[model samples]
Target: MVVLAVIIGLIFWVTSDDSGKNTANSTDLSGTPSYALPSAYSDPSASASGVPGVSGGSSGGGGGNAAAPGESPAPGEPGIPGGTPAGETPQPVPASGLCPDQNISVVLYTDKPAYVEGEQPIFTIAVTNAGLSECTRDVGKAMQSVTVLNLAGDRRIWASGDCAPVEGVNNQLLKPGQQVKDTIDWSGTTSTPGCETVRQPVAPGAYQAVARIGEKASAPITFNVNRPAAQ
Candidate 1:
């Protein structure tokens, strides 16, 4: 009976060891397949020189194409390592032309050159709007006063009374493409009565007529007064 018990115990031990070995083999086969994994697929031999997928180590990491020597960078990528992208540079703005709407201009004129001493000479000044748009009453009325000054001879043209002038002061208005004519009469007595018979020549000199439009002064138009021969 003792020998038979020993033999039975030995058989049970051998069966138990074989069963554990079979369970371990089955688990290894059911687990993850190492051959199909990404690590095994990465061509470690791709690192030679210009190999496509060699630069960036793993797929999840950034691409390693740090702009080749002088070549331009890829789209959406920065030029230098730690610098700004291509689109960050500023762009130039377009220019618009000057005073396109106003199209404003000025002109000046005078009457006969010779006049009798003490006789008021009549001069005509005409203001016209050459622009396509109507010059409102405001500008037409703002023409303050037009005065003539004798730049040469002893005679002087006075604004007080010698000249009857209608200036476009505040509230003056001119219509578009319209012209308004105004007359200025100059009458002043000369020191020499004899000067009148000889056509008292207003000495040769420079004269300027300016128009005040809005708050700005229009460029002055220059003219000259001719002096008559001495009587």
Candidate 2:
């Protein structure tokens, strides 16, 4: 009887130990309990949908950062990547204004309308700004010409540029109603292309004086030279 009781106790002990091991393995395979987990932990795809203050999702389909509503882009700045804002026209950059030839006027004058046979003629060339705005111009000697034409056959008698050295640039800013004047004294003589030899004096007669700047010219003014009376 003592041996049989010992055998029954041993059998009960072995069965209980095997049952405990099987329960432990089943618990491991079943994972955590549903009631113990947080509510948001149920969905694994929630993280990829984007969380507040966190950037998420793949690079396609407007997944990048964006400006908030009611926000405006900086002035003259591009709003979108490689794109311009709709309904906005680009402003043109301003440029410095330049002077045109139509705004200038040239006038020629002589100290006296008539001079004695031996007297020299004093000539004046005046350039006036007739525009409403200010402008710059090259008023150098290279761009000026003084010509005298005899009325007999409308012959060209003398030109200031024929014997004068024209050098240097005279760029000047001309304001509205401004005038620039230049003066020269002309000998009672004539000049040609090569001024190597002395020229004879012009005959006392009626002549027209004209001044020119670039392609623009002043209106012709009549003048006269008289023969000297016997002393």
Candidate 3:
């Protein structure tokens, strides 16, 4: 009886240890993220690799690397170890089948390269899959932003999410060379978080704009905000 009791205790200990290890190894990507801000929105003074005009970093999703059940990991595997049985085909996992950062490209654009003060501008944020395989990424409003800065780019003048942001999850799969886009309209005014401050119309001048989804940011594009007289 003592030997049997010892065996049961050992089993319980092994399972407990396994569960604990899994909890420790797992990452919660959906919850409030404690990670650093993506470089595109980050302050230039924070990092040495920051872009000249704007601070930088990214949001990229890579395919999961979960190993097959009961299988051990091998070398050179990417993402979550999707351990698959020998000779069996592996299927793409939902949400988790993210594209690697190196294979995703983010680009920013405006309907017009210039806008007059008090005129609204429509901006587009585009994400393209540059890889050869189909992979998924979270492109929801929860992961996107558009920011406008002065020519020097140190101060943030306007941001899409400053007042009221609609949050939702939108995971999409993209084939090679496939691109997806999101658009937002700027009110030609300045804003503060939570709508706490009265937004004022921006003066005519040169400005820079950038778009991003999570950590992926497009190169900054310059646009002119001219006096209505220049229109």
Which one wins on TM-score?
Answer: 3
**Model 3 global lDDT (CA atoms, 0 to 1):** 0.82
| Candidate 3 lDDT by residue in tens digits, 1-231 | 999999999999999999987776674443546776564565545654554655355435845575889998556746764775233232433466787666678888999988877899999889888776789888898898999999999988999999969799988888988999988889999997777899999988999998888877778999999886742
The CA lDDT of each predicted structure is 0.48, 0.78, 0.82
Per-residue lDDT of model 2, residues 1-231, tens digit only: 999999999999999999999999999989965665447553565565446556565567774355588887435645666554242231221244444667778899999988888788989999887777777767888888888888753787888888885876788888887999888678979877656657779898899988987777887898999998789
Q: Candidate 1 or 2, higher TM-score?
A: 2
Higher-scoring candidate on lDDT, 2 or 3? 3
- The Cα RMSD of model 1 versus the native structure comes to 20.6
TM-score of every prediction relative to native? 0.33, 0.55, 0.57
List where candidate 3 sits over 4 angstroms from the true fold. 1-95
In order of TM-score, best first, we have: 3, 2, 1
- lDDT of each residue in 135-222, candidate 1, tens digit only: 3434343343444554442344433222233454433344455666655444432223223332243444564544343433334444
Off by over 4 Å in 1: 1-104, 139-142, 152-157, 160-175, 189-231
